[model samples]
Target chain A: MSQHARGQRPEAAPFTERTPRVVAARHLTRRQGRDKAGRFLVEGAQAVREALAWQGGQVHELFVTETAAERNPELLQEASNAGIRISEVTDKAADSLSETVTPQGLIAVCDAVPQPLDTALQGTPRLVAVLYGVSDPGNAGTVTRVADAAGADAVIFASDTVDPHNGKCVRASTGSLFHLPIARSRDAAEVFAACRTAGLRLVAADGYAKQDLVEASAKGELKQPTAWVFGSEAHGLPDDVVASLDTSLKVPLYGAAESLNLATAAAVCLYASARDQRS
Target chain B: MSQHARGQRPEAAPFTERTPRVVAARHLTRRQGRDKAGRFLVEGAQAVREALAWQGGQVHELFVTETAAERNPELLQEASNAGIRISEVTDKAADSLSETVTPQGLIAVCDAVPQPLDTALQGTPRLVAVLYGVSDPGNAGTVTRVADAAGADAVIFASDTVDPHNGKCVRASTGSLFHLPIARSRDAAEVFAACRTAGLRLVAADGYAKQDLVEASAKGELKQPTAWVFGSEAHGLPDDVVASLDTSLKVPLYGAAESLNLATAAAVCLYASARDQRS
Candidate 1:
């Protein structure tokens, strides 16, 4: 046995898996992970740390390269302190485990379903962001970060969007994913129904909408418990979702470019509502 | 000599040693050929199409692989129609010329500093996006696309920002860069001063700010000719700039996330102003 294997305490057993079956099970493609394991990979030191801090129980295992463990002894210490398992592997193993070219040498396998929507929506629950077919993981992650920063009640990803568990998305959120409530719904209508039951008004963001977001917010049209819906740049929101919304709001483009990126549109809409509720 | 060379028609130029040198000069990284010659590179069928559409007189030579010419006959015809010189290169040569992993196998060499900014910003420009020290080329490109969609008068890159002509940025913009007026300023203060003189309000975006964006814009605070200033996510707008701005606005953070991505923040700010102006 290696020195690490011999020195490994009982707490590390859950995390240190050398069997090919266990190792293979841990590696999941975005689609397979989302469907089968209901888990996603979160990489980078800061992101993994955030997950450890905020959602410790949800993290399945902690993977760290020997070099990374040497560099960040505190992380290992924290895992041990939290009663979380730790696995140390070679840099090559870590690289294969990572999504990005330059992995931060740390990664976490976490539950994909996240926490329950009700738990996330608890409290006053004044503001929320509803993502409709946001196809890019980075954009989706950014929306989560913005939602967390804006103190949104929750961020719901509707069906047909990119897998939120994609590595790029986790890094883009800058560790905000740990603190943010993200629920995945296969049906947009069902997600909307939940928001409606929660007493949230749906505000759809569309470039061609006649009502400007500022105007709509100022008129108290979006003042109630609200869910801001942002769509992909390629295809705006699905027709049915747009039709079912309480109001369609536009950001008001003055240039020749046709549309703003999906995440940017969401931030603008969410911030508008945040401003209205605060005042 | 080939038929193309023999014809001396506007359509063709036989492949020669000079052709590679001409096509290579357009990129900033290529120290040899045109980049060394202070030229710039334009790549891909779409970018090349836009270059043709713009009637960009700076185009020196065009490089096309046999496959590219076969696949995009219209692109070659368009170049030929414009009386531009065209050369057929080997697949290996085309691969070497491409910046992306999958080269479209088409590229153009054009004079650097295609068109001066003073000429582009001739009229009373109403909106502008000022990027300060945003180092990511992809972010810069996305910002440009958002600015264009917002109908901003121009997009300015402050010192230390990534080069606008980067291949990744150009691709990310989805050809919006061709339509947008992108200017570079070594001194941010000078750019801000110019905008101020031009009667544009300087709205600096920072995570920590006294006023919310909606309130600021609704109060006609950022309605007029305006320059939206965004900085890198790591270090936000410089203190000096923020202090000097007409107003500093923040997107309220309701969640625990510290900040939104730079491009997202800029889009939110720009769109807020767009909403106010439209209403």
Candidate 2:
């Protein structure tokens, strides 16, 4: 409501199944278009609402169904105030734009907002999560949301990690993808070098490690400025990567489970650091 | 090596795309057939291996492609020594039985082994993870694996929770579904009664809770016999359901993320109890 004095806004465009704009928005379904256009699409009410709340100006346009618009006119009105183009699209169009079997009927076309890894590492970071060789978009996205929830300064994806702009990744992140600065490094070595240059201690989340995560934090191991490297779910951290870190810590598995899934393990490690630093 | 003393097995039947037995196994793909036959299909090499190791004779049949059997003849040979039926299936048949987009070329039909809630609660349980209204099979399964990793004595799925025998759930459990005793309850009241009778304290993992999970465990709050309740991703524990619990705990959030995901939150809570009890 701060800058909404732009007064009365024009009505939304008529519902259309296909238009030049709709065609362009649909093109965001691919990585090539996303990179070329420097834009990505976020679907559903929660994500669109979060975009308006945080990155209002960056939201280029919003597409909604009649039902969605009627149910949440506030969302459209807010976007209109921020100069975001608003339009209505057919349910079929919404379904075509969605990855899920059932589409949520609201999509926000927004400018890509990923921060450069160098920029995110320039200042002292109290906590950071580096994803190395994480190929699953869902896992990568959840980790991004978790890093934000755990109060990490940023989430850095090594060159090999899945694109955070992937629709599935955006969906999995819920709304938190926009809440934090997502950074990217050329590789793990670059991540290590940057963390070292920024005075952040590097710690790897290794399931095979003897050091217990909670115990290590309790013993002041995670009290320093930290960067937690989470590896691929299948192979874990590379041997050289783990050896180069300050120390690798594991969440203790007391029963028959081989290890916690990647996202959960990341949550435990990041929260441990959050608690250790906050305490 | 230990089991081959049973001697040379009969020659395997010729690979086929469809047969009476294959049809029956395919029917097991649905819940009605599974309940009727008291069996479910476990696919992929990892799941089948774990099924053999944990459930042993319960694995009724081994269906594999020639490639799978040739690549891992020892697996089929072990099944043979165990007196389990070993049938080679055509690659197309294997594909037909698989639920995943890219089938891993192995499937095992196994007996259901869930224990009753009362039976699981008969003995003193050091830790438990309860799914009160969890609807997603994937989340339920991961929580089961997480609980097992945290050394919970058992995992209880209340009425209306997704079936633990569901194929996706089984896959997500990574065979921890067999590693721990899985119990089914009549409802929330039955779960509460059973937990009370067992002298187990109840804790619900709520994203909205004010009580911090890490702090609570650090204070010896989780040291006593505990049962942690996890709810659905869409609708968390019912208000009445949560009100009946001893307390609800949340993982502290230091940043802008609204909350931790269902699986990750469950993992953090269960692992907290695990660490506390061990200490």
TM-score of every candidate:
0.83, 0.92
Model 2: runs farther than 4 Å from truth? A1-18, A55-57, A92-96, B1-18, B55-57
Backbone Cα, N, C clashes tallied per candidate: 16, 0
Model 1 compared with the native: what TM-score? 0.83
Candidate 2 residue-wise lDDT, A1-279, digit = tens: 112211223444445557777888888889888889988888888888888886523888888776667766677788877888777777887876777767888888988767767787767789999999999999999999889888998888885888788988888888877887787765678778988888898998999898888779668988899999999998888898899889889988889889889998898888778877887
What DockQ does each candidate score versus the true complex, computed on alpha carbons?
0.63, 0.70
> Pick by TM-score: which candidate is best?
2
Q: Local distance difference test, per candidate?
A: 0.73, 0.82
Residue-level lDDT of model 1, residues A57-103, one tens digit each, is 47777767666776666777777677766776656666667778787
